[model samples]
Target: MAANGKSRNLESFVKQQLEGAQKRFGDLEQEAGKVFRTLKARSKGQAREVEKLLGQINSDALLENPKVKEFGRKATQVSTDLRKRLDGLQTKAVEAVGVASQAQVKELNRELSRLSKKLDQLLPASVKKVTSRGSRVSAS
Candidate 1:
């Protein structure tokens, strides 16, 4: 009875450790997803703003203010260029901070997943066939 209880306690401890590890992995995955979403949303919002402004400049009503339209166009171009440069700088900054960008993280995760699947597929064949018989084991 004592041995059985000890075994059960050990099993539960192992189970708890596994659960904790799984939870941490899930949290990291979620954080990576959030980072990707944040980067994507910022870029998309900048693009949408530029597009909306450009569209307004092209509208028929804005023709009376040609100077205003020209300035708006210039502003849009400047904004687009600035956003690109800013994004580039931001990526470099993130690299400098020793944290992989969301894109790199995602790619690494994808490659890891692919390799894991491949490993799983090959694992069975890679394993040595252990014979229960002493004679067969001794022959190896």
Candidate 2:
């Protein structure tokens, strides 16, 4: 009975920790998403402003300028790099929290089920019956 109570308490503690980790992971994901969206919006606004400035200038002259072309290339590269870094940060944060992905959880469940079935097949019916009944009887 004491062992059963201890097991139950342990299970409850583990469940609560898992829940908290999942919640924190979710919050991190949301924060990352918001930051990405904000970055995208700001980039778009800047792009529009650049276009407006180009319209105000001599388009043919500015477009032909090497510096202008270099600036555009650098801006694109920076944006791409920022996005990649943000994605990496999000992935690291999730991993740091020890939260399993859905696919990973499903695969783990499948493996556990397979192992349980194999165990059932190996164990004798009598042993299975006793073990199943024994725990509840002992708890009582």
In terms of lDDT, the best-performing candidate is 2
Model 1 RMSD in angstroms: 12.2
Model 1 lDDT-worst window of ten: 131-140
TM-score of 2: 0.57
User: Lowest-scoring 10 consecutive residues by lDDT in candidate 2?
Assistant: 131-140
Cα deviation at 116, candidate 1, in Å, is 9.5
Give the Cα lDDT of each candidate.
0.69, 0.78
Q: Residue-wise lDDT of candidate 2 within 8-94, one digit each (tens)?
A: 786697689789898997888788789889999999999999899878899888888999999989999999999999799767877
Clashing pairs in 1: none
Q: Please, what are the lDDT tens digits per residue for candidate 1 over residues 20-136?
A: 656665676687789989999999999999898878775666666889789989999999999999799766755554555579769967976786566456545424233676222
**In model 2, what are the clashing residue pairs, if there are any?**
none
